[model samples]
Structure formats: structure tokens, C-alpha cells
Target: MDDYTWRIKMHQRRRRVRRERFAVLMLVVLSICGAIWYFGLYARTPEYAAKKLEQALEEKDIETFRKYAALELVLSDAYDDLTVDLFHNDTSLTPQAKSLFEKFYVLIKPQLVGATEDVICKRVSGGMWVMPEGGDMLKGRQLGIDYEEFLERSLLRSTRIKSLGEVTKENGSASIILEVLEENSHTPFTLELGMEKNDEGDWQVVSIKNYRTYLETVSPRIHQEVTEYVQATAGIVAKYNEILQSKQWDATYMSYSATGQLTKEQRTGLANYLENSVIPIVKKRQEELNQIPVPRGAMYLSNLRKESTDLSIRVWQHYVHGLRDDNIAEFNTAESLLKQMLATEQRIEDIIHRAAVSKAIPNMP
Candidate 1:
């Protein structure tokens, strides 16, 4: 072979060797990344979950609480109950588990609904009043509630404490319990709380059982408030009626509560419904009333299925999804559909002067 030819062949061989080395190096890098993800990142699920639960509890995030709570965490209403269960109960709770539960409760201190914030935060923030911590007589005085003022506040809010207790520790397990005192309702309702421990020995609540709360009941004050709200709605209802009678689709559409409470899609749903179902039935009814106009009263009617709330919620969800995806058309479609449904069932009987007349308008039927 010629010298020049041999040199060329050697050069080609070196290039091929370098290429093979480059490929091998790339493979090694990828393998290292995969290992790091599988072993280092993926393996910390429990720790991450525990941290998240703790942070959420501290932040008083109810949504996070619901998400994190599984089926085993104990929750209760009263601090006394929790302490009794923790200290006196025959169960032996792991230190880690106890700490987690304590911290979680601290996080939700303010939102104990009717409970005084001082009771929850004071005990936890400062040392226990008479706890038997080893070698340390921890005498810490935090905020104490002025029972009278607290009671007054509770009365004004129309909510009061029901029950508060923790699960007696039994065989290394404990539960939290809170009995909610409802207003003008059940005497003592109970909420069962549960928590799970993480790798770091932190107890994170995973579930709530019998989570009864006083928020469901409306106080007499609230009832009065509702009455006032209805009275306020009278003007809006009148405008709604007039807009319907005139069959001014755009005007009716514009009258919808399309602000922050109702999304763009929700407003569109009203518009579409007005154009289709609402206009037809309303027009027919108006023509009939015109032919034989009754002086007794103006009877407005609308049909609302039991699932109105559910459908509205679903449309809102769709709207949210569309917003996330930046799909304006899809969002508007959902809104339009919802609006049409609302309009179909919307009717108003406007006895302009006799607004006080109470007439039973069939809604679902």
C-alpha cells in the first residue's frame, strides 16, 4: 500500500474511535441522570408528602388539608379532649406521631371555626402549663381566653363550641375528636380526624370521618340577612323580568352577574339560553298575557333542574380547564351552554306595584 493511502486510513480509524467514545460518554451521562431521578428524586415521596402536609397545616389551607388527609388521621374539636387522649389514654403514641399531630393542629389553630384562637395557639406556642417533661418543669403561660368576652363573640357569630377531645391512645394508635355544637340544630355533632406518620416520624392527617361542622346551619341573624338579600334582589329581579318581556337578548345578557363571581363562560351560557329557550317560552307567555292581560298579578316562571348547581359547577370547571389550556373557544362554548340552560329556566312575574305579593313559582317542577 502507498504511504499516503495508509496515512488516510489511519486518520479515518482515529475519527471512528473518537465517535465511538463520544457515544459511550453520552450513554453514561443519560444513565447517571436516570439513576439520580429514580433513586434520589422519586424515592422521597413520603418525605415530600409529610413536608407538604405540615406546611399546609401550618398555613391553614383547608384545600390542602382535605387533599393530604387520608383515611387514618384523628381530628377532634377540643384541645382538652386531645390532651386527655394523648396523656391519659392507655395507648402508647410514638413521639414522632404525637409531634406531627400537634403541629397539624397548630397550623389550623385560627380556623377551628368557633374555638378561641388563644386556646389553640397559646398552649402550643408557649410551654405546657403543667406538663411532665423530663428534668424541666415547663411553666409557660400563653394567652388565656376571657370566657365572657369569648362567649359574647361566639354568640354574635351565632356559633359555639360543641365538643373537643382526642382519641385515647390504644395499642400505639390514637384518634382526634371534635364535637361541633351547632346552632338551632343538633346538640353535639362529631368530627373524626385521622393522621398518618411519615419517614421523619411526623404525623400528617390523611382523612376526616364524620366531619360535622356548624357552618351548615344558618343562625337567625343569617336568616335575617338572607331576607334582606332577597329584598335587595327585588330590583334586579324586576330588571330581569323587564328584559325578558322585551325579548332584548343582549340587554338580558348584559344584565347577568358576569363579574368575578361568574366567569366569561357563565355569562355566555346566559346569553345563549336567553336567545334560545328563554326567548321562546317568554315570548309565548308574553303574547298570551297581552291577549288577556291579567290585572291581578304578573306571574313569572322558570324551570331549574335539581342539578343546576352541579351543571354550573361543571361548566366552571370546563372554563378553568380552557383557561389553563389557553383555549378561548372551548371556554366560551361551555359558558354558552350554561347560559342557555339558565335562560331556559329563567322567568319573572313582574307585578311592578305588587312586588310584595308572595307567589309560589314552580322551579324544579
Candidate 2:
């Protein structure tokens, strides 16, 4: 009986060992299959993906563009700097100030984003905006003879992919650098695409390198016009500074009689005189400087520069409004400072708007 029982126990241990070995073998096989799927069948070649994106853009296939295209949040100190004026530098904002800032951001953000995205699409599409024979580019509209072919004929083409390098892949991410030669140049620029695998393990485009490009397709005349507008704006700003520094507004506002003499009553409240009479002079100054035409669509850079100039002027307008509101609370403490600020403010206001002081410039139609 002891011998029989011992043989039974030995047989059970042998069966257990065989099961453990089988489990180990299954794990190894499964791991090899996983590696193959992650690398081969699921993941796409980076070069192929890059070429696909290029073709999608050139062909204006909105369907394909939407498939591979994704927006990436590339965080940087530069973005922080963009918001510095709103909060970082001025941490002492009152609730009202913060609310106004938020409202301003809400107002301007969509305009900035829409305009900038249009610019980006134009750039990525090789600056091919219009269709053949002055037709509107009806993207993905089954236009005859392809958008790519249309770009090949336009004078505004910005890129032709020379060659795509072998995709570099690691840790479930891939990237490729493509050499692009333009129609007018022998030298080439490299376009790098950052790609990552999605849940289904397909490689997708994450970004278009540094978004801004050096490849704008503008006419020489437009370039010259933009240059001239920038220079003229600088000159106008200089003249504004001169007028403010000369204290011409102060002199003109002090005591305007048939003659230039002031009695004791006339000199009593400088603030009162300014509050009453200085606005007309401001109006006249605004009229004189509002002669600048609306260079809205002249050139992209010029339009942006014009917008920037107006932005500075708007800040000054806000400052003056704040000062006036503060004087109501503080019993007019900074009255002299407010007066001088408004004086300087009006000059730039007149100059930048090229229109009117205290008027809103609609960023959109």
C-alpha cells in the first residue's frame, strides 16, 4: 500500500510540471505576436505617412486632410509670454479688471485664431488659394484635373517634396524629415513631421514642425507696399511723441482767450479746463491723423502690423478709462497724471486708428 501511494504522488507532480512549461511557452508565443502587430501590421511607415499628408494637402482633399491632421498643444515659454500682459506682469488686478481682460480675450481670440488658421492652411497648401481661371478653390469639390496639378501650374507654389527619408521609429512613436525643393530654387528645405501611434496603433501626424514658414508667396509690389507702410507708421509714431513732449496740448488747453493771457480764476482748476475744453482739440487732432487709409488686405504683414499698432493704442485707451474711474473713487487724486496720459494717449489714438479716438476697430466684418 505505501508503494502504491508514493507512485500516485509522483504522477501528480509530473502533471503539474508539464502544465507550468506549457504556460511559459504560450507567454513567449503571445509576446512575439504582440511585437509583430505593434511594429508591422498596425504601425505605418513614417515616410509613407508623410507622403500621404503631402498629397492630401496638395490635392485639397478635406476628407484625407481631416483624417491624418491633428492639432498639438506645443507648450512653451513663448505662450506664457503671450499672456504676460494679461496677468503675469500685473498681478494686482481688481475683479473688474480681470473681468474686462477675460472679455477682451474672448472677443479677440476667435478672430486671431481664424485668421491665423487660414494663413496656416494657405501655407500648407503651398500657398495655392485660388483655383484655375479665377475660380474659388472649392476644396474636395471634384474639381477637374486635381488641385495638385493646378498648383504645379500656379506661380505661387511653395513646395515639391524631393524625397522622403526612412522613418525613424521607437517607443511607439515615429518621425520623418522630408526634403522639399521649390519651383524657383535649387536648394531645399527640410519639413519634419512628428507622428505618434493612436489607440488602434496607426501612426498619425501630430505637428508641422515650427508652424510659421519662410515660404510666403507675395508679389514684389506688395512687399514694397508693406515695407513703406511699416516705415510710415514708425514716422507717425515719432511725430506723436514729439507733439506730446512739446506740451503743445498743455499750452493750447491752459487759457484760450482772444489773447493768450490767464486771470487767477482761469488758472484755478487745470483739470476743470481740460475736462471742459480739451476734447475739441482731441477731436481735431484725431481728424487730422485719421487720413491713413484702411490697409486691411494690402498685405498680410502690413495688416498684422496695423492690428498691432491699434492694439497698443487700445491699451492706452483702457488705461485712461481706468484712471478716470479711479479718480471717481479716490476723489480725483491722479488728476494731473490723468491729464498728461490722456494727452499722450490721444496722439497715438489719432495716429493708429487712422480713424477716430475712442472708437472700436472691429477685428472681423
Candidate 3:
């Protein structure tokens, strides 16, 4: 053990210390890398994305909702299912007609998709969903039924997540099963959502796997609701008709002739007859109709009836005033109002008849 041997031993000890330090540094680096992967990359899993989407929907955060939801793609997929159910359930349509409707749907799909997307965005942004006035335009008259309402009732309404099933992940893609209860129906249904990782590494919902099945499951409940609404509306309309019949309205209307040229005395008689008889009865009928409770589905019919009855009162009043003052302008106004009232009445009858023919109302006339 001389000076050279001691120096060699010191050098070996120094080397061993350096090696130990290097190993400790590597361990620290690996721990940091593992933490980053777990907290950052692993946290952004498919289930995490689905939870974010659920929270966004609950909060009505449209921007965040859009970040995770491929709305256009999902809706496009849903549209096919929707049309299939629509044409399938429509008993009035022949096979040829259904084929024509599918073609028409294809032609208008882009516009419909845009419009429906806008509606969903608006609903999410507004915090509450309500069909705006004249929104029935979304329900095409060519369909001859309320398809938009059916969609609204089935999908657009508020829903509560009942349970979330296992998330299955594939090659950069995944799926999750969600059980939800629709607020309006309180019926629970299952939805399988297809998700994929985007370029940004965030997972997004691409499509609904079981949308058609969901629609089929909910159709009977929705149809039952519609039937109940139609039946309730029919009862109210029947009561209105009964009132009209009891009043002997047709005979009363035909009793007076305002068309021919008349003496001043005859004009006075016509004015008195309308003011004393027609005006009061029309006003009373309007009041009675207004007092009746209108079902939500019958709002259109109720509004139309209200307009007609209001016009009927106004028409008789104008007729009485025209005869009393010999004012031609009042007579013209009365004629215009009469025409409008008649047209409104015709529309009411048409709707009732259509509902009856659809068998929405039993013994509807």
C-alpha cells in the first residue's frame, strides 16, 4: 500500500460515487416522466371526454359542448335513422311515396342539418329550449304530419344521465354506453356513443351507435302521448260544436238578408237584429271558448278558433254600425272580416278532419 495504490483506491471510490449520483438523477427523471404521462396524457381518455361532454351539456356550455361533440356528423347519422322511422311509422304513405320522401330528404338534408344544428346551438346557448313561433316550418307540410315535434319530443328535450356503462377503446377510437332518462317522458333509454381521438389528442363524440334503436324504443310512448293530446283536443272541439248546434247558429245566420236594397226602416230592423241577437251570441261564444282549457297540442286550433270568434263579433258589430249610419266603408270592413272568419273556420274544420282520419281522436267529427 504505497502512495500510487492509495491514489488508485481513491479514484475507484470517486467513480462509484459518480455512478450512484447518475442513477439517482435517472430515477428522478423517470418519476417526472411517469407523472406527466399519468396527469396529462392518460387523463384525457375516452371516459374523461364523455364526462366533460356530460358536464358541458348540464351547464349548457355550447363552446365546450362543441369541442367534444361532432354535431354535424352525429346529426347526419341520426337523420338517416330519423327518416327511416318517420317513413316506416307513417301508415298513410305507400312504398312509392316513402321512396319519394327518402329522395326528397336526401335533397334537403343539407339545409335540414344546418337548420337543426342552429336550433341545437341556440338551445344550448339560451339555457332553455322552446320552439319559437312559426317553428312548425321545420315540420314540412309535404310530410303531412308533425315530424319536427316528434324529433323535439324524442331528442331535443332535457335529459338526465341515469348510468354510464363500460368504455371500450380501440385503435385511437372508443365507445361508451350511456343510459339517459328524457325529462318529458321519464323513460330511460340507452345510447352508444362512438368517440375518436382527434389530431389534437382530445377525444370527441363522432356518432350515436343506437339512435335508431332509441327512436324505436320511444316511439310507442310518444305515439300514446300524441293520441292523448288529440283526444283531449277533440273533446274540447266537440263541446264547441255542441254550443254552436244548441244556438241554432245556421238558422239565425240565414234568417237575415243584408244583400238587397232596403228602405230605411228595413235597414234599422237589420241593425237592431244584429246588435241585439248576433253580437251578444258571438261575444258569449268567444268568452265560453276562451274559458275552456286548451291542451298543449291543441294550441294552434285554439288560436285559430279565437281569431275566428273574435272576427265574428267584429263582423256583426261592423254590420250593425254600417246599417245604422249608412256607412259603406263599415259594410266593406264587415265583409272582409266575414271572409277572414269563414276561412279560419274552414281551417279549424280541416285540422279536426285530418286528426280524425289519422285516428288520433276516437269518434272525432
| Among all candidates shown, the one with the greatest TM-score | 3
Taken over the whole model, the C-alpha lDDT of each candidate is 0.43, 0.47, 0.71
- The model with the greater TM-score, 2 or 3, is 3
**Global local distance difference test of model 3:** 0.71
Q: Model 1: per-residue lDDT, tens digit, 154-200?
A: 22222344544644435543456655554432234565555555555
Task: Give the worst 10-residue stretch by lDDT in candidate 2.
Answer: 72-81
Candidate 2 stretches with Cα past 4 Å from truth are: 1-43, 72-166, 178-191, 208-365
Which is superior by TM-score, 1 or 2?
A: 2
RMSD of every candidate to native, in Å, equals: 25.3, 20.6, 8.9
- Count clashing residue pairs per candidate: 34, 0, 0
TM-score of each: 0.25, 0.32, 0.60
Per residue, candidate 2 scores C-alpha lDDT tens digits across 228-342 of 4545556565665565545546745554766655554554444444444443434444444455553422333333334434443443344334434433433343444455344
The alpha-carbon deviation from the true structure for residue 92 of candidate 1, after best TM-score superposition, in angstroms, is: 50
With candidate 2 superimposed using the best TM-score fit, by how many Å does residue 343's alpha carbon deviate from the native? 23
> Sort by TM-score, best first: what order?
3, 2, 1
RMSD of 1: 25.3
- Candidate 3 lDDT over residue span 47-119, tens digit each: 7788788888788899989988889998899888887876555557688998998898887777667667777
